[model samples]
Target: MKPIPVTQKLSVAAQLQPDDFQELSRLGFKTVINNRPDGEEASQPGTDAEAAAAKAAGLDYVFIPVTSSSMTDSDVRRFAEAIVASDGPVLAHCRSGARSFYMWVLAGDVDVQGFSDDKLVAVASNIGIAPDASRAWLATHRRTGKPDVKGFYDSRTGSIQYVVSDPTTKRCAIIDPVLDYDEKSATTKTEHADEILGYVTDEGLTVEWILDTHPHADHFSAARYLKEKTGAPTAIGAHVVDVQALWKDIYNWPDFPADGSQWDRLFNEGDTFKVGTIDARVMFSPGHTLASITYVIGEAAFVHDTLFVPDSGTARADFPGGSARVLWKSIQDILALPDQTRIFTGHDYQPGGRKALWESTVAVQKHSNPHIAGQTEESFVALREARDATLPMPKLILHALQVNINGGRLPEPESNGRRYLKIPLDALEGAAW
Candidate 1:
């Protein structure tokens, strides 16, 4: 079996045959780690046979079975402990070795080396492993990418939507497209979303996915409208359930389903997918909202609500389920991306009355962002909370959330044959305005 070396002392390999224990010992490996759960594959060898062969070959073996689909932080901690207990060089095996590599990456996620998924995939590919087994990992921790990113700014809510296109196949994904609503007259229009649809039509791009970073507070989501217009599926972060639960109590909607049944797909952390040839992944970036996620497509990070650009500082973590301390860590993760990685934020307030801008680089943010540059986590949290306390809640927070939390669909028509939004008095007690 060809072994992929992750480090001088640790290596990963595909399912090792029972007869391969001697070879592992001969290669100077002192311990073997089995990361695959039992019965994962019908043709795979049993752990007992592998353990028996390892014992006969004088190599220590540990069965730390892990399900690739449902890996947890505790699993990573256990794998790290197992590695520490091993003697000399350690060997880990899974169906294709990607899961082992992912574990190592997770164990080192907080380590100083900052091993990202881009680095992991590159190293795995060099060792003859196809590495599709860790698509979820790569998507969330992608280091470098260059998808064609175009932003559409909605003047009403100071929100920015995006149409990310794959250069090769002309397939695209719409991100955070807004459904314009006039709170004054309760008028709903598609002007904001139609602009993006027009761009897709003009470019001859096929709409494959209509994505939302989270149910926006400042604006209604055009996800349902766009899905109907383009015949594409809609998706959002899975933790949006937490947002729905919190809002349901405020609105007193006993019948609201907080199970994330609204969207066609509910993405968990590290989930990966594709838009044409461009690989996209999800990273759960809560704090600004309980379900905020960053879409890492190639080298571009669609960091919604975590950052507002260098001039405007970061997003306010004062909404329901928001945390300033958590937002600080989320911003740190975004800053960890490659220096040159293009960052596309969710909104731009056009501070100083300048033209709206939505693009920046990680390098730019780390060095120049007023909220980030020279600020430690504690300092950033203090600053963010102080600023959040003085800011008014988004004008559309109440009206938008009901529609946004329900996957961008307005509430069903009432007996009068028209939909209406329910506004709870004093529901947001801490709203600055």
Candidate 2:
């Protein structure tokens, strides 16, 4: 087979490939990291063929297979070491590039400060990867020195939702919260949001902003509910307009607002705001979807769904409008941050059936993530694209996108005064491609 061509370059460090080793060499990549395990018969080319091609192209190659449910911390650490020992731009690949991209994101030297879920997704997609799972994982892993902050996280939804309080002013702002939704009841609940509200009331913390990294696909956002209850402004990435536009068509909602006026604040790239003691900056990350963003606060970044616990790897970018090329770039930008910066993601599904583990140091990720370390942009892209080709669309894509694009609010009530979710028959056929 001929070498693959590079279709997207992730940040200044990564790239997406359609199996073009010559292009990788031409672009000055010296090493390749393969994240795909052998024998994923449906979507990937055989590992032996990839290794032969890499050697034939005069590049050093290493294969470190990482599965979604089986990766360990040691695996992540080893991968990071490989990147440190390598020379020149490295390319990492796996099915869909998410595994490789996440490994690199876990590798320290990346800054996720001010990146939102939608922004993370955008940046990830720019290089052809997905940030959804990674973004959620980031949130679940937040770290704080304040006892109140720590206590709050420990008590709430096994997730972190913080309101930074200034010593002088005691006022605070909330970032990325969980508003519990009862799927069986088809009704939204306020158990999680109420907890935060109680904290605000008891601690004398003034509510400022109800922030979200993106419209979460896996969980309902409590932004609207919180905003309704607290009168605080709810905000998200400005690119949510794009998400709204995309999902509006999918849901066939004629009444949905395409202009993005629904959100109190629609942040754009490089936007900044004051949230108590923290100055939140916006970074567009977007591989999981077109509207992901990251929020940078002080030395910590609420990265939402761009990365995971580092040990378990990164997010998935298989949803519609998601691309492996974009995810690679987003991860590169995150990996370029200060080494000690804490990267907090949105969710986690712990391996070993242990309690869900969240949080990973930037240093820890830089050295260990199995996917992206020691991989070049070109090679990583090729691997990601090939891998993504075999993935199936996310299970909750339709339901999630519609609600998420609306800033986590459900569709409007119909004539019967009940909201109904639409399922387009045959619309998703051959979606694995």
Candidate 3:
């Protein structure tokens, strides 16, 4: 078997045959740890036969059966013991090699020289291991730093705009600002964006960046308007190019460039930037929209459209290019943040007509959010799909996308000096009647 090395002394592989044991020994593995239980599949060998082969090959063998359903602290302890007791290089095997790798991670104390815990967990997830255990480990070890946060509620759209600032430097970024729109009048105004500007001016805060979580469906982004007013750069997730391509087809804009040039910076997953002196990074949190992202600035996560207040539940994932399963995974990642990390959501429907509220913590969401808290992946998908199936398309979806995809700029004035919005008939199919 070809082994994928995890550390200097350890490597992992899929199920091994009796003939494979001699080749493993020849390759200088001093011990073999079997993480798969017997009879898992009809074609696989039993533990006794595998142990006999190892003995014949002059290599020590340790049996540590692990399954996704039955793994426990005791299993981790046994795996740790086997790892510590081994004299030299170890080759571990499981059905698909994920369980063996997972056990090694949970055992802890292994010096994966170049990997931080977050990076290590991401690596495990990429290799097909569920990240819950490691996510908990990450949350427990997260750094503690509170960045000052201010949320402005827009009663009209049920959206909340934010200004996350470094208290020491008084430097901040405006997130998901809205450009006021009156649907009946077919006009847009700067009232919402100006209010944010007023807050910045009064607080002596300098705007460093103007960011959008995604191309919004319900409201026009004020990224371009705010950039003109504050002179700060505008940014969005890099996958916006994908959204641009999709929408350009529906709008029939043959010459439109869909290369993500609309924004100043296109952020990729794990991309890091600074909000003043505070450390900030990007998490690609798509599902509500193809290009959605969450900005984890200091100890606060600007999780636009992924989650809402614990009382309000989560965002809807029925828009074009959205998926319930993908949204579930995105929410899990946000919940994986430190328990104390402040979660600022994009919209708050003010469910039950309660007063507008927009902030919650990771711990609160894990315990109180009905959309999460006890729901498995399968169950969550069922709930979300059923709920979304009944909901009508957002009233402003068509009106908002054209402007948002162009970085919040309204289309240029026509020959008569009047700007216009183009509405396509019969474009959105399967919308609620």
Top lDDT prediction, candidate number: 3
RMSD of each: 15.3, 17.3, 16.8
What is candidate 2's lDDT per residue for 259-285, written digit by digit as tens?
A: 778778899988988756556688889
Name the Cα RMSD for model 2.
17.3
- TM-score of model 3 vs. true structure: 0.67
For candidate 1, the per-residue lDDT at 8 reads 68
Per-model TM against the reference: 0.67, 0.61, 0.67
Give the distance in Å from residue 315's predicted Cα in candidate 3 to where it truly belongs.
0.9
Residue 40 displacement (Å), model 1: 59
CA lDDT of every candidate: 0.83, 0.64, 0.85
- TM-score order of candidates, best first? 3, 1, 2
Measured on C-alpha atoms, candidate 1 has an lDDT of 0.83
Q: lDDT tens digits, residues 1-433, model 3? A: 7787787788888899999999998998989999999989988988999999999999999998978667676776666656655778899889977778767755543423224456667766655556886666445433234456778889989998998887668899999999999999998899989999999999899999999999998899999999998899999999999999999998999898899998999999999999888899999998888999999998788999899987788888999899999999999999888655667889988778878877766756776789998899999999999999999998999999999999999999999999999888889997996
Deviation (Å) of 222 in candidate 2: 1.1
